[model samples]
Target chain A: MAESMTETEQRPSGVPYPGTPEGRRGTGDPGFAPHDGQEAPELLERSRALVDPAMRAAVESLPASMRRIARYHFGWEHVDGSPAAGHAGKAIRPALVLAAAAALGGPAARAAAVPAAAAVELVHNFTLLHDDVMDRDPTRRHRPTAWTVFGDADAILAGDAIQALALRLLAEDPHPAAAPAAARLADCVMELCAGQHTDTDLEHRAPEEVTLDEVLAMAEAKTGALLGCACALGALYAGAGPEEVAALDGFGRQAGLAFQLIDDVIGIWGEPLRTGKPAGADLAARKKSLPVVAALVSGTPAAAELAALYGKPYITGDSEGIARTALAVERAGGRDWAQTEAADRMARAMQELARAIPDPEAAGGLLALAEFVTRRSS
Target chain B: MAESMTETEQRPSGVPYPGTPEGRRGTGDPGFAPHDGQEAPELLERSRALVDPAMRAAVESLPASMRRIARYHFGWEHVDGSPAAGHAGKAIRPALVLAAAAALGGPAARAAAVPAAAAVELVHNFTLLHDDVMDRDPTRRHRPTAWTVFGDADAILAGDAIQALALRLLAEDPHPAAAPAAARLADCVMELCAGQHTDTDLEHRAPEEVTLDEVLAMAEAKTGALLGCACALGALYAGAGPEEVAALDGFGRQAGLAFQLIDDVIGIWGEPLRTGKPAGADLAARKKSLPVVAALVSGTPAAAELAALYGKPYITGDSEGIARTALAVERAGGRDWAQTEAADRMARAMQELARAIPDPEAAGGLLALAEFVTRRSS
Candidate 1:
């Protein structure tokens, strides 16, 4: 699929694909931050107080080798069990859960505490583990994949455990609505699995096999559902009104879609050194990403040529061909098409943000959080 | 491992050691008499009302290939879309769910309907599908495995989708306690995964290498958890007290363990012409089963010889050796040990059954259920 890369010049060179370390993006607004310098320690302190014990309890229940791999993935254990501060993820998803809940008027102190934070974090990790296995990925967060370490079965089982722990924590919470929260969480998990199934199916199909509608549906199932659930559950915790819960869910849904498109862009054209993933890795894998699909549908000469090359099965040592295909896709307006879509999605997300009736400042903070997610560089 | 067949009375001629159907055991307690005589038609009617719709809906959202395999496994489809009444399982577990809920004073009407029944059944099917893949089984329920028809990936994704559907159904139930019920179900799901991990590991480890304690733990994790969850959820649905819930869970747990031990016996000494699975199949696979484990710990000379024979990596074609090993294990008191253990476990299970304040008539029915499970013959 060929798309003109010339019109979209603001993109940074190197960022890892989604589900990787370099994929982390935050708001570009200079004035916006997760916390003021003074707030960082308290947030970290509070987070650690809750996350550590829950994580330990969950992992301890796992088999030894599985625990080892999970620990390594979480930056808690080295391959050889020596002390090592491994690359902990930014924990953005969990932070979003807390921030959204607090923004909905709950005390940040209890809203963002251990069990919830740990639940959300574990959900994120569970997805990472399974996604890596399905994609046959070998590295994540700039380290070897968990499957590569503990073997695929152990990795899968560990991931499954993390998912269970997420639900278990929510159920065990003493909140009046703990049961309802768990029910909501289970629905989101179903969406996650459905999204993944769609994603996996895309690989075996033609480049033009999936439509924009399908992509949107897939995004809703994959990324949007989780983010929306995060916000909705947060609002529930904060005792936010029904309208506010609905608004935040809408906001998260739109923002999550935009986030996925931006991440897709980064996967293809991003710089290898910065991303910590091989350059044009997505192209080499011939992933049926949005831009590639867009270009394939455009019917331009460049698109035709690119599609011709992609019609064949993927081969090793063909990264150069894949790169050329990527270039052709760019020349055909695919890149511009995706960028416009992402911006539109973001605008709608902000519109939803504006409809919220929470405290203006807290709402503003959540809005800033959304912006941070779509705009950040890894 | 060197123990001779002459040392034990367990060995019998005309009982195929491999490549022959295993035997089934029936309790002869006439447990299903009450339901079978008057309630059978109504149960089927009620089940069909819920099961048909839920089963259709669950697969409706899945991709075509996944749907195909699932439909095939459900005995709903063939390769050419011709009408095929596939081998639908006995649906014993779902019946247990409904019966347990009904026994706890819940109406067996909509409460015992499709989504929950289908969900539990799908969970069982999900396990079967994956177990087939892991055990390298080529057949299930007397037919080719799903993997044989749809390939490993499709079979896996199908199983995964069904699992998601199970959770989704539980979460979406309109009952007030649906949320908590779902959370409990997830706990069971996680335990099942843990059990599967242990079971797979046992396959790789020598049969005698693992201890009886470990085997019991594995059995509890693998089979008991789901049964316990099913019974507990059913009680929860019926508005049963926490005490009742705990008792039902205990009942299912003990019965499930006993079921496994009996299953192990069938796998070894079954009548080859009756059970679809090969007789002594577990022996050929050198599975680290209950009886095998018991034999290893008995400290008899025959037990020592059995251990040596089991240590060999390959036993696929050594049917004679397997028969000899089986006989030696019996002579060493392994068979007796296992039978006694099974009986003890069954007694314990029945003890739990005694705690429930079931209708005296229903109490006998429940006991019959337990006997049927643990002492079934086919």
Candidate 2:
């Protein structure tokens, strides 16, 4: 599954802001004609409507001790435990699962994969909870991270229980595909863990010690693996054979990589109002994100300057320093490289999607999703 | 599954040290002999032989970054990653799984349950790794804890991977019972997380605010739940009916409670030489172990003294304070209550085992293993 979809349907339209660098603004839209001529939000909303019951049931089934924290994390309850309208992300991963199922096996397979979709979402949130604790991240989705609210031990426990719940959902399912889905999901979890370990390990070393390849691999494992697994699971539920499953997985993984590249770009230039995180926070923390690594190894004068700036410790409220650092990275060709890399990855993703489902009409929902995630915070 | 086995076969013989109180010094020995009169050590050793490869394969399958830390945690390799003779534990949990399977369906059942057995052990180690981090414990199995050897982040990631591996093993097994067993194992993990959550929550509160019943429930959840699940999984593999599986689960849970009660007692009164940890370490940390809570709520005069002593923060190397604290617990009848409670639990366990497997000879291995754990630290 590797480049036959038209460039117009696979390219993202870039949004320019104050921090958006030259050569990256207003790129062409990935002109996907979604199902029923619908968009990603519609597909996501439909998927959410179908998957919400299963997700809520899984959360409700948790023991009281863990249920409270999970409820808050999922945005279904306030910190005080009162009900709230859920704001649990765009529900993108589950949408991917449902879309992939629909593409291969129609509505029936999509419905059959509900438990698995919920399981995938649960895994994503589980990693989020643990990652917040490990990274000492203070906020997520415009609220205090669970560890900051319930304390680290409780947050960790909640995450542990959620992971179990995820597996239990599949294990208890009568669907024949459930067991293989579980094994694949569990394997994804280990990859996620290893990715996190590498991320943390890399963070402690000098910027020069970290390679672009290493950071890319870390991103793939950390971010791409789950997306791949979700799509693979959807294929399994649809009774798609091994080749199709692998192709779908590759599609998701490539899209996920493009998603990461765009996400990293957003981490540097995204609007706070849209992204729910402060602009340039990653740079402020001296995080060795993909663009930063790319710029560091560019062998240019600006790369040296960027390296020197990163060598020094970041101080709080150093907005001036952050601005200068962002400039150095741009001058070192980071932003342009990231934009090009994202387009390349999305093209690869389109190839995989086309290989798996040759008809554009059948693949509309998935095509919309991949484009949506890549363009989400632009 | 209640009260049918002979009393002599369920009671554990006691070993006494200077700290052992008068009432608990030499309780009568359990008289049920092991298969071929081999006893627990032989059974455990044999089971270890059977399950070790599966455990090793699971660990080795981990990604390179996590594998190093997991290897160190399992005592299979040193911190530097060179090989070492494995000292993972006594292999008790897996042994129980094998024993229960054999009791129900003989050799084939036991053999089929190997992956489940390895999965259980992995879950146990995963919990240990996280608990050590949360508790900030400096040692485990007489060596530096994983969190201390690697940083907290790496240890946590390793634990996370091991847990995923645990479920993955069960998920990958082709046996008919694997799905149910994985679901059961995952459910136990949730219970384990909740138990740990309660334990951490209780640790931050005043000792007097804690109740005996609360601690008892916590102990059962933390220690007994997995043991019960292990037995139930074994019974599932053996094709046992629901009633028989429930009985075996009951047997394991009761025995687990007894194990915890004695472990708590040992935490407060055993010789450090045998226990491999300081005798008063739990007391020094003001841990709300089973006996400690029992003593605190005793309503005896010594209970007040113990509470007041526990109220003051412990200074390291205060041998006099530790001695006084141990004596206070004893005088308040914590020791006596624990011994009596353990015996009652053992009796209940015997009843469950007899109900599930009426033939004493067939049940010999399980009986011996249960008695061995209860007596090993005595």
Among residues 3 or more apart in sequence or in different chains, the pairs in candidate 2 whose N, CA or C atoms overlap within 3 Å are B3-B351
Tens-digit per-residue lDDT, B230-285, candidate 1: 67776777777888888888888887887787677777776455556566777777
Q: Report the poorest 10 consecutive residues by lDDT, candidate 2 chain B.
A: B1-10
Model 1 clashing-pair count: 34
Give lDDT per model, in order. 0.66, 0.85
What is the lDDT, from 0 to 100, of the residue B352 in candidate 1? Answer: 62
Question: What lDDT does candidate 1 reach at residue B260?
Answer: 81
For every prediction, compared with the true complex, DockQ reads: 0.30, 0.75
Model 1, range A209-301, lDDT digits (tens) per residue? 678678778877788888787777776677667787787788788878877776677677774554565657778777877778888888899
Q: lDDT tens string, model 2, B113-228?
A: 99999999999999999999998988888789999988888888888888899999988999999999999999999999999999998999999899999999998899889888
Model 1 bad stretches (over 4 Å): A1-69, A80-84, A108-117, A174-180, A208-212, A239-246, A311-323, A357-360, A376-378, B1-69, B79-83, B106-119, B174-180, B238-244, B313-318, B358-360
Worst 10 residues of 2 chain A by lDDT: A1-10
